[model samples]
Structure formats: structure tokens, C-alpha cells
Target: MTTLPQISLAKLAATATRREERQRLQMACEEFGFFYLVEHGIPKEQITQAIEASRRFFALPQSIKERYGHAAQGMYPTIARGYSRLRGEILHPDAGPDPKEVFDLGIDSEGDRRPFAGSTRFPDDALAPGFARSLLALQTTVLDGVVPQLGTALADLIGMEEGWFPRHFSPPTLGQRVIRYPARGGTCAKHTDGGFFTLLLQEELPTRSLQVWFRERWMPVPSLPDSLVVNLGDMLQALSDDRFKSTPHQVAHSGESDRISLPFFIYPDIDACLTSCQGRHAFRVAEMMLRNFESVEAGNGAGRARELQ
Candidate 1:
């Protein structure tokens, strides 16, 4: 069985050792475009609590969960920062809406009326106690560390200047989705992520559900103990001018019980203009992200697979 390469986030994030680890990280990004991130240093209890809270949220009555549904509150179709009900989001056009339910939260902002920017719609504490806090705490900690450090490392891999990526990401448009894939329904069809990169903590199952297209075959990615799976996204692929790949992946769950996975998507600020890592022409972050958001929601996929061709 093929397993994803394990990259030590501790070493990759360390300033002294990052230079040494960059070659390995780059190889993983280019060859597999994904890896298992070990020694990320997030507390075990925090990961447990976040996953438990997410499970509890999904167990809630549909009516209660819909109280914070994102579609109604979002200023634009692209804003999906709240609870997204099952079968409401379409990631792969052929598979239709995924049978998974998701609750998303991003960096809190006040009065930013643009798409993908605004205060998160948090559920009432009474409705789902600790649901908000646990998830937010996990997301916050990851953002504070990997969102910057890992991002910088990726930039360096593509020859981006030191500290240049952070400038555009000052107040990044990042978000984490706590997803629940129930027992009965269609599988999560093949699709590439639409952002810059993703940090995922998935439940280890007897049957592998998460897979990546590699060497002309779909390979299952095992869930390792205390490790988060990291993958590049299309935006980063474009930024790297395909020097890095945004590998296509999917979930085909055959398990009877519900599964919960936490995936954090990292991207630059909405208003930031991003170009190729080689300093080519640029496009506004908001436009591309919103377009991606709309397409993914509408089951059009990220539509960035064309970049590879």
C-alpha cells in the first residue's frame, strides 16, 4: 500500500532547520503535492475536543444547525463561513453535492462588506456548547503558526522572496471546515482544492476514504497517528507556475459510522493581488477566490486543472 510522505512540520517551521528541510518539502510538493505533516505540536486534547465538538454539532437537529446556515447570512454567494447543510455544496460536478455537512469559520472581521470577508456566524453557546470555542481555538493556533510558517516555506520553495508571502497574507482570508460525512450517500468525488494550501486532520478509518491521483492511479492516503495531512491547492500551483502541483483528490467512504475531518484552507487577503512566484502579471485574490468558491459550490470544480494542461 502506498502512503503519503511524512514531513516534519517542527523542522520545516524552524528557522535554522527550515533551509535544510526545504528540499524535502519541495520534493513532496512537486511529486505528490501532498504529505503527512508530523510533529505539528498541536495539543492532542485540542484535536480531540475539536473533532468531538464537530460530531456533536452534526448530531444536532437539522433545524438547530440551520439556524446558522451561511447561505442566508452571506453578503455574497462566495461567503460560506457558517454551517453548510448536507448536500448543499457541490465539489465535483459529476457527483453532485457532496453528502457531507460542513461548518466553517474564518478570521473575524468587522464591517468588511467584500465577499469572503466578514464576521463568522457562530452558533449560540446554548445550542452547541464548546463547539465554537474548540474549533476556533484549533484554527487560531494553526493559523498563528503554520498559516505563516508553512506558507513562507512554500513561497521559498518557489523562489519567492523571504517574508514576501506574509505581506500579501496580512490578515489572510483563511478558513477551516469541520466536515461530517455520514454513512449513507454519494462519495466525495475527485476534486482538487481551490485555495493555496490545506491542512487536514482526518479520522483514521479501517477503509481508506481519502485518496490522491498519483502516477495515473488513485492512491489511498492513510491517516497517521497525531499527524495532519497537508496538500497544495490550485492557487499555489499557479503561483508556482506548476513548479508545485495541486493534486486531485477525493473521498470514497464505505464506513457505516459518520466521519469527521478538519481541513483548514489558507489563502491571501481578499484584496491582495497575486501573480506567479516569478513575478509575472497579477490577478486580484478576491476575484479568483470568489470565482473558485462559486464554481465549487455550483459543482464546477476549481476549474484550475487546465493550468496543468
Candidate 2:
């Protein structure tokens, strides 16, 4: 096992209640770009069951999996359909094509009605017995453990009321992606997350390297068991006036074995606007990031770069 950084959520959560601790969390966010959350309240069994269900779904035949393809909403099973593919322009240009297949889900909010809106689908109960219920249970537990705490901490970091973020997220729209990477050599190209925050639950340790861009260099992030890797996104950076960095990252192609990962991306309300310390610009940075990400995925590298800049 590789050595990984340890962050005490208990300490961070406790600090969130106090002004000083809030400052520390904000400082860490600005400086490090990422953090490890430990002792989060999600149960171990729930994570395990979800992982098992995910494995079963991915093992299905490609034809069977195609039943869920949702290109219109960017949901369903697909390989590299949500981001750019151009060389030297896509986030991970140097790395080879990402040898992975993924199923993505978006949460349902007000004015939106869709099954598994803001969530992913497992094989139906008949296809994989107990899969749907077990996965939903895990999702609920994980969300209960992290969402409130994360929102509160973020609110505190911005010196806002504890419930400030919650107001904007009452009907939060989360994106969950279950990814399966083929055996070594198919690595994810370098790129930054397009949401406000990401919580990655790794089912199996990755044999390929995972690197994060920090201080203008790619630094490897070690994978640890039973821990979720959390990363900030561009919305946070915009809200913080670039104080909180949104680091670029990628997974290297592995040669030893295939890999699986479940990442839950937490996003704000669709219409929510991002402002700064003075609350001057009420622009919707989150939506913009999403738009740019989609453009890149559609092979509009030049357009995406312009929007990003």
C-alpha cells in the first residue's frame, strides 16, 4: 500500500463550529487544493455493497449495458463522451485515450422529473438482485455523512451562516459516475473536475498512477483503502477569488489489472450564482463550467479553452 495523507474529519468538523477552525479549513482549501476525509460517518458495509453492485453491473455484456445509454442528458454507459478528446488540448492530452466505460447519473431537482435524477442506476432488481436497493442505501448513507458536513464547512469557510449553502442546495443535484478502467495502458487524461466538489470512493486500489496538478507540476496522489479522495472544483475557486485552487488531475493507464471507482460529484442548484467576498458578481460559474466541459467533450477544444480562460 502506498502512503497517503490523513485528515481528521472529526477535527475538521469540530473546527467548523468555531471561527478559528473555519479559517484553518479555508486556508487548507486554498493551499492544498485537496484533502482526505477520514472517519466520515458512512458505514463500511454500505460502501462494500455498493462496490459489489457496481462490479456486477460493469461485468454485464456490452449489449445489455447499452439499454441505459443516455447521450442526450449525458447519462448512461459510454466511453469518454462527456469531455474533450482532442490531442494537446484535452485535459489529459499526454496520456492515451482513457480505457474506461462509465455510467453517469444526475439528481432530480425542482422542475426536473427523471428516474435516478442526480443518481446512477444499478442493474434492475431482476438483473442483479438487491442491486438497486443496496446501491441506494449506500448513496443515502454516504450523502448523509458527507453532504451536510461538507456544505457546513464550506459555508463556514466563507463566513456565511451555517445553513447558507443548504439554502442553495435544498434540492441538490448530484452526479454519480461508476467507472471501469481496462487493464493497464488506458489512463484518464489530465483534467480538473467540473463540479463544485468530488468525493471518490475507490473499490479497488489502482495499479496505474493517479496524479494531481499542484504548484504547476503533476504530483502523484496515493490511493488508500477505506478512504475517499476529495477534490475542489472551479466553482469553489471562482467563489474564493482563486484562493482555493482547482487542481488538474489524471489517472495513468494500468498494465497489471482493471480498476473500478465510484465518484460522487456534488453540485449546487442549477440557477445558483457564484459571488466573491464582497458579493459583487452574481454570476453562475457552475453552469459555465458545465457548459465548457460539455463543449470539450464534443471535440470543441478551442471553444472550451476560450470559455475556461
Candidate 3:
């Protein structure tokens, strides 16, 4: 029944005494593994345009969208890029497939042969004008602008150098995804994200159905307008030697109209290896996705639990 903490990026930056902010971030990561971010400096207009552009893209005919589908174009090997239809991805074996459609894009490169270093498939000019530009702008803002600040705060909490966390993301292997769940009760089964963190932007609708597993129960996450919800991911949990939890969360079908969400996964270089100072354990970035996929397919019960509300 505890509400997620709301942390102000501006306050965290300007405050002379950062001890409180550091403690708050540490506790949130250790306990809830989720929080609301405010005043993060990403323009509201950019966020709005990104959402509107996504709406236009999804409104296109199913056939046109399929032309750019991830599987149709063999984009699965890159981890996640291009379009995926509803039920295309099964993140939880016990909960079945997720009833959602998503368009994914990741760091673009030509020379790097890493698992996730590949070009994104953008919509053609005939589909939606400026769609690629708007989406890219929003993605860059969060990755370049918002992430560094949060990363610095995280490093401070852990007693590492200020920029230690963000430096690993130089030429980051991150991904941006825009998803739509039509109708109510479209469950995105309980699971943890596979990267370092996730920043989600959701439209404020009649129903906000995101739930986080906490304190041995499922808890509802309020949908606040003009705010981004940030959560820890599996890689971070591993990096912290399980000190920072990667809380499991799921999206229950909304009983109202369609629901749209934009979630960006923060990844490091494919070869980046994270070692916890406390536990002396090492986690490779490249292997985390494969490990997570296997767990989901094998019905691993590590992050899964009863969702009774």
C-alpha cells in the first residue's frame, strides 16, 4: 500500500545537501525498485510529439505495419528492433503471451558486430511524415539528458565516482519501444526488464493498470501526467549483488479504451561487464538478455509470483 517515491531531478541537482536525495534513491532501489521522476528536463512538447506520432503509426493498416515487422525482417537476433504484433513476444511462460503491439529501435551502427548493434527499421515516408524524426528526438532526450543525471545520482548512492555509471553507456546499446494494448485486461505478464533500467511514459487515460510486485503482494501504480516512471532492471540488480531489487511488474488489461506506453530500456555496451564492489560478482551485458529469455521460456519462478490484488 506504499506509494512510490517522487524524486525531483531539479531538486537533486540544485540541493546543497544531497545526502537525502542519495538515501531516497538508494532506498527506492533497495526496496520498491521503482519511482516517479519529475522535472527531468525532457521537453513536454517532445514527449507529446512522440506519443502523437506513435498513435498515427499504430492507426495505420495492419498490412503496412507488418511490412516493417521485426520477425518479418529478421530483426530478432539484434535483441529487439522493428515492429512486433500482439502476442509476438512471450515474456512469461506461465502467463502466456502479452496482448500488445510494439515498435522498437535501438542504437544505430554499421561497423559494430555486437548482438545489439544494428540499424533500426524506420517507417517509410508514405506511412507517416516526420515519424522517425520525432521518435528519435524523444529517445535522444531521455538517453542523453535524463539518464546521465539519474546515473550520477545512482553512482553517488553507491559511493562510486560521479560519472561512473553514465560512462558505461557511451554509445549505449539502449532501445526505445512504443506499445499499444487494445481493450481492457491485456496482461503483460509479471516479469523484470532485462537491462539496467527502464523509463516509461504513459498516457493518462480512464484506467491506469500497471502493477508492481512488492511486500509479497501486487500493488497498483498511479498514472501521473507529465511524469516518467523509472524502475530498476535485472542487470542493475545483478550489478548490485541483489542489493537493488529488480521488482516484477505487469500491465493488466485496461477496461476502458486502448492504452499506449513508451518504455526505453537502458543498456550498456554489449561487452560491458558489471562487477559489484560488495559481492565481487560479475555480470556481462551481452548475456543478460539471453538469460532472461531463457528464464521466461522455461517458466523460471525467480521474479514471478501470485498477482492477487
Say which candidate scores most in lDDT.
1
Greater-TM-score candidate between 1 and 2: 1
In model 2, the worst 10-residue window by lDDT is: 79-88
**How does candidate 2 fare on TM-score?**
0.80
Q: Model 2, which residues run further than 4 Å from truth?
A: 1-5, 15-24, 71-97, 108-122, 204-208, 279-281, 301-309
- Top TM-score model: 1
What TM-score does each of the candidates earn? Answer: 0.93, 0.80, 0.91
Candidate 1 versus truth, CA RMSD in Å, comes to: 2.2
Q: Per-prediction count of colliding residue pairs? A: 0, 15, 4
Arrange candidates, best TM-score first: 1, 3, 2
Q: Which stretches of candidate 1 lie over 4 Å from their true place?
A: 184-186, 279-281, 303-309
**Given candidate 3, what's the lDDT at residue 259?**
77
Rank the candidate models, highest lDDT first.
1, 3, 2
What is the C-alpha lDDT profile of model 1 across 61-107, one tens digit per residue? 99988878876557565446788777887766666778888887887
lDDT of 3 by residue, 130-249 (tens): 678888888778877888778778766655566677678786677788888888766677777878789998887657689888888888888887788999887777777778888889
Better of 2 and 3 by lDDT: 3
